[model samples]
Structures are given as structure tokens and as C-alpha cells.
Target chain A: MIEIVNLHKSFGKNQVLRGATLKVEKGESMVVIGGSGSGKSVLIKHIIGFLKPDEGSVMIDSVDIANLSENERYETRKRFGMLFQMAALFDSMKVWENVAFALIRHGKLKDKEAKEIAVEKLRAVGLVGVEDLMPSELSGGMKKRVGLARAIAHSPEILLYDEPTTGLDPIMADAINDLIIEMKKRLSVTSVAITHDMHSAYKIADRIAMLYEGRIVQTGTPDEIRNTDNAIVRQFITGSAVGPIKIEGVTA
Target chain B: MIRLIELIGRFVEILWSTLMSFARELGKILLLLCATMKQLILPPFELKNTFKQIIEVGIKSLPVVVITAVFTGMVLALQSYTGFKRFNAEVLVGTVVALSITRELGPVLTGLIVAGRAGAAMAAELGTMRVTEQIDALETLATNPVKYLIVPRFIAGVIMLPSLTIVADFVGIIGGYFVGVTVLGANSSVYWKRTWDYLEITDIYNGLIKACFFGASIAIISCYKGFYTEGGAEGVGKATTGAVVLSSMTILISDYFLSAWLFK
Candidate 1:
């Protein structure tokens, strides 16, 4: 299980996350939902040790990861994988190389072995024949698939997604949602996804949490989130501007 | 007088702020440098990627570097022949051409060429990655940015600059010889012999050393500018320009100090 306990993070005077607490059980998919600038990404960064929390701790597999040294972070990260918003594919590397980057970097496999594994992972993501193509050559959905392939290539126990479905069309988003579900079912991995896309949350989440004003306002099952009377959750989930979320900076 | 005083005060303030920021950023760079050195020494040094980067920065930059050097060489010989003829010192033109290029022009022109091509490219590429959150993605993946990105380029720059300078210096000398014999109506033997006599290992070494420092300065400044780029497209563009300009100015300034020490 992964746990975030009393996590606080601030950038200067602007507090991003204040005492934000959450947990996802082993073999669980927990989707975090929030409006724009609601600190979801900051929370993910803190969990990944890319940003240290000002106070409190993020415990992964019952270890306090926030206090780990850089080497320790590397070791800890061996158990984790992530799909970034832009897909973050290393443009310099070909598709197979991108998929097998960790394998090559850590010296866990030889070139031939890594290539085989990369091909297998690409196949798992439904991208078998495109191994020689560059990230720029892939379409948006294909890039995300390749990103997913690379993320899970190492068989991480934990998978994190930052706005995984943001740039995809509706059908592609649904396809990705299906892929996420299929991966979770097969690997029994703990998945934590941060996004404003409620359709994705509804599709992949076992439990949904709404982050607002730097704190998690509501945490419950998907049905519970849908039926909740909280105005913020309603405004966010229903795509309505009638309630608390202001429209001056955001389009929807 | 009032306006001048006000302007001077503001300038000092800006200087102070810049120095303060430089000190802070320099400290961070030193720490990052230590981390990079550590990773480089350790097993699994990512040799494949480093070689790729070398090919990208050093080998790929050749055409521009050569073109610029040849032109500068031609121009230098043309200008100097006019001045040397007044003193009837036209035969010594080869000596002067070889010396000036070795001591200053080779390193300076190569640095400028790289500042435009490699340096700007590094800044923009890294800056775009910075804005696009790819660097952060690397961090999340437990890839050290300095070790993976900056240090390889830094090492490559230090290694390649002198080699590039050698090429530039060689091409430049030949350019001078061509101009002197063909265009300036000078004896080829006199030009080549003077050049050989006037030039030595020390002059070549001095320029190579200058190039080492020049390459380091450009890589460091460009990497720093790009690594911390914020905002969007405009911010990335500004950072690339800032890197090239800053790298050029620092090379010129550092050149003076290097010359004083070398000559002394």
C-alpha cells in the first residue's frame, strides 16, 4: 500500500498542499480529481520524491520515502513507474530504447535481452511493429501508449499517472482507460492518477478523492463521489461553473 | 548629472543582485558538479549516451566552425597585408597571421560559432524540455539531470573545443597562406617558412587552453540558463539568447585574464 500522511508543501507564501492525507491499498486504483491549480500534480511530485514535503511523510510499502537519500530514492524508484502528461518520451531515443531505458541505465539486462524485453513491453501496450520509430513519429495516443509501455517495462509495483487522458480524444481516452484497467487487473499494481478528467476517474478509479484549496475535500468510492452534495466536487465533476470554482483563469 | 547618478545607482543595484544570484546558482552548480563526477566514476556510466552527445555537439558542429574560421582567416590576412606593407614587413605577414589566430582568433571565433550553433541549441532543447516538464519526468524516473544532461555536454565541450580550435587554427593558417600567395602576390615559401618559424607549441597550447575555458564557460552558462527556464516559448527564446550573449561576454572577459597569466 502507498500512504500520504499529513503532507504539507509550500512554494514561498503560496501553500500548495496542507495536511493532505490519502491512501491506496495494494491492487487499488485511486484517482485524484481537482480543478486546475488544485495541487494534484504537486502532491504526485511529493509522492515521487521529486519535491519534498514541507512536513509529514509519504510512505510507500510502509517505508517513509520522503526522508530517503538520493541513492535510496533511486532504489525506491525501482518499484515505481509513471506516465507523464506530455508522455515525456525521450525524443533522442527510439521507441524500443525508450521502453528499455531503465533496463539499460541500471545494467539489469544486456542489449539483446533489453531489446527483447522492450519489444515485449511494446507488444503489451499494443505497439509491436513501431519499435524503430521515434517519439516525434508517434501520434499523441501512440506516444501515451509508448509512455505506458516504458513505465511498466520494469514491472513496477506502483504506477502513477499525471493527467494521462488530458490530450486524447474521447475514444482514445476511453482506450487508455481500458488499457489502465487491463494493466491494473493483470499486474495487481497500486495506481494513483492525478487528473481533472472525471471520465477517466470514473473509468479507472476504485476510489476517488477530490483535492481543493490544497487539501483533499472528499474521499470515497466512485458512486459516493457522484452522489456527494459537496458543491466543489459537484462543480468539478459535472463541468458546471455555477458554484465555487472561479472562471476568470479557467475555461470550463 | 542627476540622471547619470540615478542611472549609475540602478546599474550598481542590478550588478549587486546579479552577483548575489550568481553566487547562489554557482553554489548549486558546484554541488551538481560533485554529483555528476560521482556518477561518472561509478559503474554503468552511460558511455553510449555520452558518445552520442559528443557526436551531437562536437562532430555535428564542424561545418559552421570551419566556414567561420576560414572567412575570419581570409579577412585577417587581407586587412593585415595592407598595414604590414606600409612598414615593408609584408613577408612577416605569415608570422603575424599564425600568431594572432593561435592566441586569440581561433578560440574566439570557435566559441562564437559554437555559441550560435551548439550553445543556443543546447539552451533551447533543454529549455523546451524544462517548460514541457520532461526534466521533472527524468527526476521522477530517478535519472539525475546534471549527470545525464549537463556533465556529458560539459565534458564534451572541454574535450572538443581544443580539437575544434586545432581545426580552425589549421584552416585559418592555410587560408592566410592562400590569400598571401594568390591574392596578395607574396612568395609561398616565404609565407610558409615565416609561419613555421613564428609559431611554436606554446602558442598552440595557449589557444587550446583558452578554448578549454571558453567551451566550459559556454556549456555552463547555456546549461544553467536552459535548466532553469520557466514560463513558455518566450522564456525559452530569451534564455537561449541570454546564454549565447553571456557566454560570449564571459569568454572575452576571461580571455583577458587568461592572456595576462599566460604572457606573465
Candidate 2:
């Protein structure tokens, strides 16, 4: 469903992504595992047409999204729903309003209909009776659940999760992982998630791709990744400090 | 001699870069203004959001604008009375207060107040949105952040600053009247007559025109700073400060050019 070829991005003198490339099949859950600042977010941003690459193209279903006009890009984005790392709920809005935002704004649904759908999606994400509460009133886990509810509210064809399990307790993170699995099953949509949490990645991803430096270093199933011979992949999965992957801002 | 020449070269280089940076920022601000204008005229007018912003930017700012205008008028009256007393020109105090409030003080004070109040709030709110990724989330939901977020605020600023200035002008004139007639013991009829005779409709309109420009500058600059905010919480703080400072400076600096053009 998505193909990123030879993608390169630089912020001034800092070169982030260099020749990064990856692809994901439709209706499959693809998880990208990377350390912090590995350009995982940059890669997904390109897919969503949020950022144009300094080089190469991001193709979605055969159309290069980078080349689309602003209006056309907005049209193409309707198929995507993203849950940000911070949940990124509109603090000004109620939980239900946040969930129903795309529905009322883009889908042009009536408020009553939108609210009903928002409530339904919230329930699906195991959240109930917190619809009217503001985002500031919600717990971190609850916020993530609300974000998930919002992401799935519009019935998007492609769902993107950015560090969905981060900043939550182990149990909450695992719950989020389970929710990701449940969402994939229920919606049958293509998903691309980026995270450094190996457990969450293993649990939710049908296929896992490891992003290193700025490029995809390896792609494999969870079992294959766990048993891989590649030193970088093995070191990453094992959570070893001593590895070929140099820890940024640290002297070896 | 060689060292002096090197220092001169370095200074020139620094000056050139600073000028270039200023020009670049100005260009970006104009581009953002153009984008906002395009979105505003296009279909899907966010009347509801615009009204909401109008309330926030105009109605909420009424008390401060009124207070500032009243005090400014009173101060102007008191100062002019004292100064004109020396020349036996006490009768002209009303004319000075009315002319100053209507022609300059009303819009400028209102603009500065709104920039500090509404403009700072805009920068902080949008900066928070940017940092939290709510803006990106909006984009993913197929909404143009510019159209959804900026255009309404822009419309509200353009509409409300002038409305606030009108209120400021009236309240300020009344304030001058109160000081001149009741407190300062000037002739009530003389004060009213002089104010009416000297303050033209064109003077009021000129201030209002300046108000519109100030309003546009505040909204666009605030939105620009907030939209491009990076580096998280500290960045939001910096953007808020930059918005208020830049908007106020723009109002004051542009007031000169606007006054010269409109009054001339």
C-alpha cells in the first residue's frame, strides 16, 4: 500500500534520513522499530505527505504523494488516521469532540450522528462514559485510548501509530499493543506503527522493520527477527548496550 | 591596519546576514498572509469559528481597551491643560485630547493591548498544538490547519480590531469630556463644540484603517510564530513573547507610515 524509495531528508547541517527505503503490503500491520531520532517519524511523515523528501518519492498505491498539490494531498490524506506519540488530543476539545473531529469536519456528519459514532469508537477502545471530559482530565492511558478512538473513528483505510506504547506502564503498554492487534483485526486496515518497544512491536506487528541511522536495516517476522544472525538486528532485539549501533551522544 | 580591515569585513558579513534573515522572515509572513487570504475567500467559511474568535479577541478585550483609552484621554487632558495654561490656551485641551485619541491613540493602544492579550494567547495555543502534534493530527484527519486554524483567527482580528478601536475612540472622548467638564472645571459646551469642530470623520476612519493593518499584522505574525514553533515548551514561550513584541513593534512602526499615507 505504501512504497518509500531512496528517501533523504536533512535539517540544515544535520542529515537525518539518507537513502531510507521501505514498503508495506495492504491490510498488513507493519511496525518500524528504531531508537530515538532514527528518522522513523520522518519516514511515516513522508508517507502522509506531511514532509516532502529532499530526494526520492513516497508512493501510496502507485501515486507519488510528494508530487500532489496541497488540495490533492489533503484529499489523499483522508484515507489516513494517525495516533501521535503524545496522543496530541486537542486540549480545547472534549474527548468525544476530539474523536468525532474528522467525522464532523470531513465526513460532514451531523453532530448527533458524529457523537454517536465517537461514543461507539470510544467503547471499542475500552473507554466508556468519559466522552464529555476534556483531554486534560484524562489519564495518560486514557488519553492514548481516546487517541486510538479518534484515529479509528473515521474508518480510515490506513492507520499510523507513532510510539503508541511509549510513556505508558508495562501493563498499559501491553494493553495498547493488544488494542492495536484488535484494531487491525476489526478494521482490516493497513497499519504502519513506529516504536522502540520490542515487546509491543513483536505483539502487534505482522512484519517488523528495523530502522537504523536513517534507513531500514532489516525486515522480518517477529520470530525471524528474534532469531536473526544480523548483528545489528540481534543486538537491537536483545537490548544489548554493546553493539554496532553507536549510541548517540555517548563515547564508545 | 590588516586587523581593522578583517574586522570591517566581518561586520559587513554579519550585517548582510541579519538583513537577509529579516527579509526572509518578512517574506514568510507575507506568504502566510497570502495563504490565509486565499483560504478566507474560498468556500467553507468557518463562520462559527470566526465568531468564536471575535468574542475571544474583541469582546474579551473590551475592558482593557476601554480602561487604557479612558486613562489615556484623561492623562492627555490633564497634561494639555497644564501645558496650554502657560500660553492661555486651556480652551484647546479638549481639541488636543479628541484629536489625539481619535487620530492615533485609540487604534494604537487597542492594537498594542490586543497584541499582548489575544496575540500572545494565539501564539501559545498554536505553539502548544504544534509541539503536541495536534496540528499534524489535524492534517492526517484531512483538514487544512491553515484554513481551519488561521483563517478564522485572521478574519476575527481584521474584524475585531476596528470594532475595538471604535469603542476605544468613543470611550476615550467621553473620558476626555468627564475630565474637562467635571474635574478640570472647563466649560462643558466649549469642550463639546471644540471636539466636534476639530475631530473629522476622516480622522476616525484613518485610525480604523490603521487598526485593520495592525490587526492583520498581529494575527498573521502570531500565527506564523506559533505555526513554525519548534523545540517544545521553551519554543512556545519564545514564540508567545516574539508574537507580542513583534506585533507591538509592527503597530508602532507601521503607524508612522500609515498615518503619513492616510492623513496626507
Candidate 3:
């Protein structure tokens, strides 16, 4: 279980997160949906201990990660697997090397053993016969799948996905959405995904949370979120340009 | 009077911000250095990466360092001939070339060349990694980036600079010998004898010491710039440029202080 309480984060004058609270049960898929720069990424970064909150407690399995030492934080992070928005594969490494990076480094697996697992994971993610290729050679959708393969290579207890379906075609996006669902079902992993893709949210989320104006405006089952009467939620779900939720610095 | 005061205040504000920025960067660099040092002493030293960096910084840079050092020595001999001929001290040309190359030009020129080559490469590579989130990915993998990415490079820099300087010094002396004896009609035996007589172990050691410092500074500055890069492609370009400029400047400036301290 992951619990965040009253998270407050600011960058200079821009308050990205303001007293935001959220929780995810064990073995549940919770998707946080919001527009760009809506603090979804920030929330994930805080939970992962990449960025500390100004005032909050990120409780992972009831242990407050905010107060952990550097070494402790690293140990805690070993339980997590994150797929970045850009599919942040290490360009210097081969695809197999990128997938096996965490396993070799943290898990202390031999190079040969790690590569075997990397190939297996790649196959699991529906990619094959591209282990020796560089990330530069992979297509956008392939890179995302490779990223997913790398994330699951370590078999982390928790999975975090940032903008999973952002830069893919509708077909590729649907494939990824399917993969996320399949992975959750197969691995029984507790997952937190942040994406603006409503289609993806509805497909993968057991519970969906809407982050607006630095706080979680609503969190409910996908069906409830679909039927919610909140004006902000409706405006966002419909992707309307004109609504009570103002696009800052732009006039409606 | 009011306008003048306002102008002065604006100038002070600019000056203050500049100073603060410099101070902040200095602090960050110092902190990074401390962390790197701590990692150096800790267990699990990365030998493979250290060897790779050594080959990159020391071996691959050999051609450029040789070209620069050889040309500098040849030019020094030719110019010294012109100056020494008037004073009837043409025999001392060999000693002059040997001393200058060993004590100053070899280390300084090598520093600048490596700063341009290896330093810029380090910055650009690390900068790309930063923007691409590879550094963050390393952290997620439970790897200390300072340890995994930086310590090996730092080790290579400190160890290889002096070794390269040795090559530069010897090659530079040979360059001077070719010019002094072949082009300038100086006595080959006299030139060789004079070079041997005037060049001391201290001069060579001091120069090597300077090269080590230059190497460390170049690695640190380049790594630091790349580590903190924001924005994107433009930011990486800026970091690469900043790394070369800062490393070269640091080598030149530190060379002066090092010379004074070592030879005073």
C-alpha cells in the first residue's frame, strides 16, 4: 500500500502540488489523470523519493519514505520500477543492457544471466529478436515496450508509469493500454500511472483520481469517475477548451 | 543625483547577483568533489570504467597532444634562435627549449588540448544523459550516479594527465632537438649536453604535478556542468562550451599559482 498525505511542493513561485492526498490499496491499479504540468509527475517523483515534498509523508507499506536516509531511500527504491514519459532508455547501452541494468546493478546478477532475463522480459512485453540493438534504433512504440520490459525486469513490487501512451498512434496506444492491463493482472503488482489519455485511464484504472489545481479533485472507480457531476472533472474528461478550470495565462 | 544613485544601485545589483551565482556554483562543485572523494574511499571501485576512461582521456588524446607539443617546441626553438643569435648565446637555445617545454608549455598546452577534447566530450555525454533522464534512471536502479558515472572518470583524469605530460615533455624536447640541430645549425652534441645539464628532476616533477591538477579540474568542471544542465539541446551545448572554457581557464590560472608555489 502507498499513502500520501497533504503533499505540498513548490518550485520557486509555482506551487505544483498543494495539500494533495492520495492512497492506493495493495495489488490495485490507480491511475491519476490530469493535463500537462498538473503535478502528476511531481506526485510520482515524491512517492519514488526522487524529489522530497515540502510538507508531506509518503508512506510505502506504512514506512514514511520522506525521513529515510540516502542509503535507506535507495533500498526502498529497489522495490519500485518506473517507466518514464520519454521511455528513458540509456542510449549508451544496448536494449538488452538497458533492460538488465537494474538486475545487474542492484540484483547483482551476472551479465549472461541478466541478458537471458532481459530477452525473456522483452518477449513478455511482445518484443523479440532486438536485444543487441541500441535504443536509437527502436521505434517510439518499441521503445515504450522496451521501457516496460526494463521496468519489469527487476520484478519490482510497485510500478509507476508516466505518460505511458503519450507519443504513440491510436493503435500503438491501445496495444500499450492492453499491455498495462495484462501486466497488472499477471503480476498482481500495485501500479500508479499518470497520464492525460482518458482512454488509457478508463482501460487500466481500478480507481481513477483527477488532479486539478495542485490537489486531487476527485478519486473513484472508473465508472464513478465517468458518472461524476463535478464540473472540473466533466470539463477535463470532455477535453473542453472552455470551462470553470481555466488554462492559466490563456483567456477563455 | 537621484538618477545617478539609481544607476549605481542597478550596477550593484547586477554585480551582487553575479557574485552570488559564482559562489553558488563553487559550493556545488565543492560538494560534488566531497561526494566523489567519499565514493572513492568506499568499497566497490569500478575498475572497468576507470580503464576505459584512461584509454579515452590518455590514449585517444595522444595525437592532438603530440601535434600541439611538437609544434610549440619547434616554434620556441626557432624564436629562441632569433633572440639568442643577437646575444651570442645560441648554444643555450637547447636548454631554453628544454626548460620551457618541461616546466610550462608541455603541461599547459596538453591541459588546454585535453580540456577541448576530453572535457567537452564528458560534458556533452553527461549532459545528454541528464536531459534524457538516464541519471535519474541510474538512481532508480539503486546506483549512486556520482559513484557509477563520475568516480571512474575522476580516477582516470588524475592518473593519466601526468602520464600524458611525460609523453608531451619527451616529444617536445625531440621537436626542439630536430629544429635546433637540423634547422638552426646549432651543434648537436652541445644542444643535447646543454638540455641534459639544465633540465632538473624538480622541473619535470612540478610540471607533472600541474598536469595532475589540470586533469582533475577539467574532469570535475566538465562533469559538474553536465550534471546540472537544464533545458535541452541548447543547455547541453552551453554545458559543453562552458566545460571547455572553464577547464582551460582553470588550468591557466592554477598554472600561475602552482608555478609560484612550486618554484618560489
Best by lDDT: 2
lDDT of each: 0.88, 0.93, 0.93
lDDT of 3 by residue, B127-223 (tens): 9999988898888777899998889889888988888899999999999999998998888899999999988999999999999999999999999
Model 1 over residues B124-210: C-alpha lDDT tens digits?
A: 988998997878767766688877888787877888888899999999998888898999989988889999997888998999999
The alpha-carbon deviation from the true structure for residue A191 of candidate 2, after best TM-score superposition, in angstroms, is: 0.6
Q: What lDDT is reached at residue A50 by model 3?
A: 87
Off by over 4 Å in 1: A247-252, B1-19, B22-31
Candidate 3 accuracy as lDDT = 0.93
What lDDT would candidate 2 get against the real structure? 0.93
Instruction: List model 3 lDDT by residue over A2-63, tens digit each.
Output: 99999999999999999999999999999999988889999999989988889988899999
Interface RMSD of 2: 0.6
TM-scores of chain A across the candidates, in order, are 0.96, 0.98, 0.98
Pairs of colliding residues, candidate 1: none
Query: Please, what are the lDDT tens digits per residue for candidate 2 over residues B1-264?
Result: 999999999999999999999999999999998999899999888888899999999999999999999989988898899999999999998899989998999999999999999999999999999999999989998998899999999988999999999999999989988998998999999999998998889999999999999999999999999999999999999999999999999999999999999999
Each candidate's TM vs. the true structure?
Answer: 0.93, 0.99, 0.99
Model 2 chain A poorest 10 in a row by lDDT = A13-22
* Tens digit of per-residue lDDT, candidate 1, span A1-252: 989998899999999899999988999999999988889999998878888889989999899987788789988887889999989988877999888988877756888899999999988888769999989999999999999998998888999999999999999999999999999998989999999998899989999999998888999999999999998899889999688877656565
